[model samples]
Target: MIKRILLLITLILQFSFLHAGIVILNGLTHSYTVENGKVYKGKIAIENTGSQPQSIKLFLQDFSYTADGTTHYTALHSHKRSNGDWIKFNTNLVTLKGREKTEVFYEIAIPDHVKDPGSYWSVVIVEPVEDIKPSDNKPGVNITSVIRYAIQIITNYDTEKAKPDLKFESVKVEKEDGKRTARIAIANNGNLYCKPTASLEVYNRTTGAKVGTFSSLTMGLLPSTSKTFYIDISKVPPAQYKATIIATDEDENAFALNVELEVKND
Candidate 1:
């Protein structure tokens, strides 16, 4: 004789959008440059694209990511820069009909006595509460998956005092399947968050003549956090070269590094 057990899996999806079912109509991120003791307001437009109605539950969670590609959603105020306590949502639960859309509102009240003028942030999670039934009557186990969305709310206080200090931690160049790439890791050692773009310039080691230049997409970097940037170098001919990589934010803050590379087709 044998026994059977059933299992259910729940996963919280991060980022701006989902493919089907509940969709975010407006956007996923709300960024604000705020002043002390001021109240700011915003809204998230959510829609049920599925034919069936959906019940959504909203709440706040602290957000953080690491260089190793680990993301965390912990209790409110879990981080030093978490502004969870400063936010108030209009409602926690909402019901939507098929093809129906609605707006969820919230307000952020900046504290007057906030001493540190940097970045404070949190996330509003919109989760669909669904009662799923097993598709087949099996003797084994069954699984059900639930998807959710995270809306990032970022507030920057005192831009002057919230400047980002970034540094390069590591760089590596690799060749695979006849393609070459450079991976660079960057860390923010400042008190604020910054969106930075990275560019790579290659020069001939023997002649110092510029060979090629490439840039990466912009990504948000938070204080005490780090991210990896990848640049394609497959077009560059196999040869010894010198490269300079620069990372610059929207505010014109730039950091650069120089390295030597020896490339080979094999």
Candidate 2:
């Protein structure tokens, strides 16, 4: 009963976050292909879902993440490849009435001195100034939940000259929730961003027969960042096997790692 109650609370919190009073209508990622010494214009659309008025503050920040699920946010221009200095917004704060929709305009001015063909990025954060609290007055404790959204702004210059370099760091298998999973850690070592997909091919050691082939979900990897790919291997039969793990990006850049796998199914 306690576990079920906790799960209910978790679901409610997730729903609240997804259905926030202030929402960004333009999606989370805004990507652009730009040239040096050029100016690009864009806008972010926002809408107030609740009936009451909502005040929102918009700001820029640098964001970084790793394969271990650790994330860091710092001041604008903190990252080496951040484009924070190039972006300018028309406004930083706004108040919206009930069901009011608005748009925020911004521009990116690429400097003439930029000669490198690479990808630069930054994040625009939109947060509500008001805190949402539970409405029940008889509650012993009132929980306040504050929600914010970070929209990634990416600028790619000279895509023909940019290259993708993916590094396969490690691979391992683990059992959890009555299933087997193969996890692979991959890093983006090049100047561009990549969406990498991982695959595992297993072969029986004794018979030399192909056991199975499994693939993982493709995920985006930014420059100097890493992500873990998880492939379900629960259907593979228990046996001693030889396996080849391959990580491939959209550009067909592939990295392979060979390993011996033992599936006890215990």
Candidate 3:
């Protein structure tokens, strides 16, 4: 009887190893940005690179870091396992071919009541479940494999009440095809709606004479919300250029903000 039991155990381990094979090929969407009180569309794409067919499960969970730098994961979907904090949705399963790829899409909405502007990260995990047949005619084996991807979320607040206190938080300039392009972040701290309009003015810093002006279309800024604007500075010669951002509220109250940037010839 003891010999039979040992044989059964060995067979079970062997069968478990042979029955399931799973590998993760790719993960989609590394970063995402959404304005406060806006809806965001998120999707994850995964490919099965294993030899055997398998059923894959997906779930969303929150990862928290403690004061001592310890990390813990809490399930965000309530229907799978009852943990007090539930965000939404439940576990979903899909079958994949030996080398097939699939995509899963979900929507997330950020409430307008969010008070802070910052970054948030979340993970979407894909688990593969497989069944194994025992060689000794004992119970079958079940195997699970998982893959996870990190997502970054940025929230910007733009509302109607904050206009005059708008300021440029940061500006990044990059050259492509001999043209200078800039990505600018404008933040509003006052009360009122402000629309951003920018004009690139080149000046001889010491002479104070405007060399050229390149204006951009106006973009709306809700109170307390930060808006990102893109501008092209290639037209201005290789010199010091002052980007004048003019913000106008619904009532025609306007404010002028300026940032000095340099253009270098390639």
TM-scores, all candidates, are: 0.87, 0.85, 0.39
- As for candidate 2, its clashing pairs are none
- As a whole number from 0 to 100, the lDDT of residue 159 in candidate 1 is 78
Q: What tens digits encode model 1's per-residue C-alpha lDDT throughout 30-70?
A: 89999999999999999898767789999999998876688
The Cα RMSD of model 1 versus the native structure comes to 6.4
- Taken over the whole model, the C-alpha lDDT of each candidate is 0.85, 0.88, 0.56
Clashes of 2: 0
- 1 or 3, greater by lDDT: 1
lDDT of 3 by residue, 1-266 (tens): 99999999999978766655544444332334446566666555666665567787766665433222245566654222111121233337878787777766666666666553333334455667655555665577645544444332222244332234667667767788767876666666654334566555556677777766666667654334476666787776776666565555545666666778777776
lDDT of 2 by residue, 1-266 (tens): 99999999999987765554888898988989999999999999999887778899999999878888888889976778999999999999989987899999999999998888889999999998984565757758655576789999899999899977888788778899998998888888899977889999999898889988999999888899888999999999887899999888887988888889877768
Greater TM-score among 1 and 2 belongs to: 1
| RMSD versus native structure for model 3 | 14.3
Of candidates 3 and 2, the better by lDDT: 2
Which portions of model 3 miss their true places by more than 4 Å?
Answer: 1-29, 65-70, 77-91, 132-266
Best by lDDT: 2
RMSD of each: 6.4, 3.9, 14.3
The worst-scoring run of ten residues by lDDT in candidate 2 lies at 130-139
Model 2 bad stretches (over 4 Å): 1-20, 131-143
